[model samples]
Target: MTEYMPIMLDVRDMRVLVVGGGRIAGRKARQLAEAGADITLISPEAEPEIRELEAAGTLRWLRREASEEDVDGYRIVYAASGDETLNERIAEAARRQGALVNAASRAQAGNFIHPAVLRRGRLIVTASTSGAGPSAASALIRELDERFGDEYETYAEFLYFMRKKVRETVIEPETRHRLMRKLAETDILDQIRQDTFVPWSETEAAAWIEREREE
Candidate 1:
């Protein structure tokens, strides 16, 4: 088994290929398109959303079966065709081109697996079961989505701003570490829950730190 190195790829302006027109393929293509990838979907038939994207010019839909040439010059390829033989062919072609290939049918055939992901502003959470059960992974992701709530968005945004401020204002490494620890300990989630938008100032954060130290 190859060790997976997790990475968040910026697919913006990259060419992506989807070799199926079914619901699963459409879902994958839609996500790639949303990430600003130049998606080309090759399918003899397409779902309504795929057709919609084609009409809207968000994605290019080829009304034909995927060919080896379709995998050429693509940064990433998704083989979601119902036909296992065609999917394998697509994967093989993509591998030959040194492009990243995702086999929706067989995980071992591809180099990477797409985890169920939830995005909240700059924060993204993903759930993966190493291809053991995609449905379980999706269910876990949904559970996390419900548990984390919208307050996490505000909390994460505040942390981003806090980190930037700390970098600019505090020069000492130890002091910065202490400050960051303090920020982590503070109940920012509680603040969000209470509808407090206090801007997460250094003074407030430092006071929280002092209070924690005393306790």
Candidate 2:
């Protein structure tokens, strides 16, 4: 069994091939499309949903059986044809041809595992169990979804905006560090969650730090 390492990939404008058109393949294809990959999906027959996306030109459709040649020239490939032997074969060929693969059945043939991901505006969370406990991972996501709501979206963005201002204004490393932590500790995020947050000026956020420095 391969111990998988988790990392995010920048697939924008990258070529990705999905070797199936069933429901499973359609789901993965939709996700890759959302991540901005230039997708080519190959299948002799496809679900109506996948065909609908193809009709819209969201991804190029190759209405044919996938071959080893189809596995080449792609940055990433999804082996999801539901045929165990062919899926494994495609995974092996994809790896040999220098492409990352996400296999629906076999884990060892691929380099990475996909975890259950939760994305809020700027807050993204991923839960996985090394592919052993997918149910547990999904249950954890439900718990997290309840605790972290839309409030986190605005709160996270606010913190980022203020961090940049602190970088430019706060010269002392120690003082800058303290202010960054303080910004989070203040009731600001709570305010954002409750829909009571008001935008603050640069001096408004940094004023207390200036006071401490002068003292």
Candidate 3:
């Protein structure tokens, strides 16, 4: 088995092709659509959710079997036709077209694999078992979801806002780096859990940075 490297891809508005009409294809299409990918789903028939998305203009659905030529001009291709042979064919076509392919039936046949992911605002946690155990990966993601609750969303957002403020305010590179680390190491998460977390405005953040400099 090939070792896969984890990466965060920015697929916003990227042309993507999904070859399948079953539930798996619908799921992959929905995830890609949510990430702002320009998706083209090729399937003779589709699940209700896929149809809804097509009707809502979220993606273009070609109601027919995918052809090898359909893989052209796509940045990413998902071969999820539920038939191993069809998926393999699509994967082969995608690879020839210099597109990254992910085969649903066989991860090894493709160049990439999807991990079980959990999102909390800007916080994203992903787990993969190297295609050996998807259920284990999902279970791990579920555990992480329970550990990092809704409060984490607000916490992460606050940190992101503060990070920008820190970069803009703190002039010294070392000081800025230290302050950035200090911000994450603070007891803010505890305060959030206790319902006492108050967001700092730009002025407050600057004041805090100045105080840290003094200390």
Candidate 4:
């Protein structure tokens, strides 16, 4: 069994290739495009959703089967042509081109796997079963999705702003660490849950850090 190391990829504006035109391929293309990937999908014909995406300027759809050379220059490749043999061939080409690949038809043929992902503003959560099965991973993602709600998005953004403020204003390392920790330990989340969390302004953040520094 292959032990997969979990990672958060920054695929924004990265070149990606999706070789397929069916539901699975459209799904992959949609996800990649949503993540800000520059995608070029190769297939003789694509599903309506993919066509819409192309029309919207989200991704380019090439009307043809993918050749090995198509995998070149792409940072990531998704081989989801719905044909096991074709997927394997695409995966092999991706490997030779030094591009990461996700093969929908056969996971073992690819070097990487897609995990269930949930995003709440700055908060990103992912779950993977490492090839055991997707059902279990999806179940875990659902549970976590419910556990973390929209309020968390605001909470995360608030924390990020405060942390950056603290880093910029506080010169003392110890005080900075203490203030950062205090921000995390604060009851802001409770207020957020209660719909009472007031966003901190730059002046407010600075004043809070100053008061903490005095203590």
**Candidates in descending TM-score order:** 3, 4, 2, 1
Off by over 4 Å in 3: 171-173
Error of 3 at 95 (Å): 1.2
Kindly list the per-residue Cα lDDT of model 3 for residues 185-205, writing each as its tens digit: 899989999999888887898
Q: List the candidate 2 regions with Cα displacement exceeding 4 Å.
A: 164-179, 201-215
Which candidate has the highest lDDT of all? Answer: 3
Backbone steric clashes in candidate 2, count: 0
Name the regions of candidate 4 deviating beyond 4 angstroms. 171-177
- What RMSD does model 4 have? 1.7
Tens-place lDDT digits, model 1, residues 14-122: 9999999999898998898889999989999999989988998989888998887788899899999898888888898899899999998898787788988988887
Best by TM-score: 3
lDDT accuracy of residue 215 in candidate 1: 43
Q: Which 10 residues in a row give candidate 4 its minimum summed lDDT?
A: 163-172
Candidate 1 matches the true fold with a TM-score of: 0.84
Using all chains and alpha carbons, the TM-scores for the candidates as numbered come to 0.84, 0.85, 0.95, 0.92
Question: What is the C-alpha local distance difference test score of candidate 4?
Answer: 0.90
lDDT, each prediction: 0.85, 0.84, 0.91, 0.90
lDDT of 2 at 114: 83
| Model 1 accuracy (lDDT, Cα) | 0.85
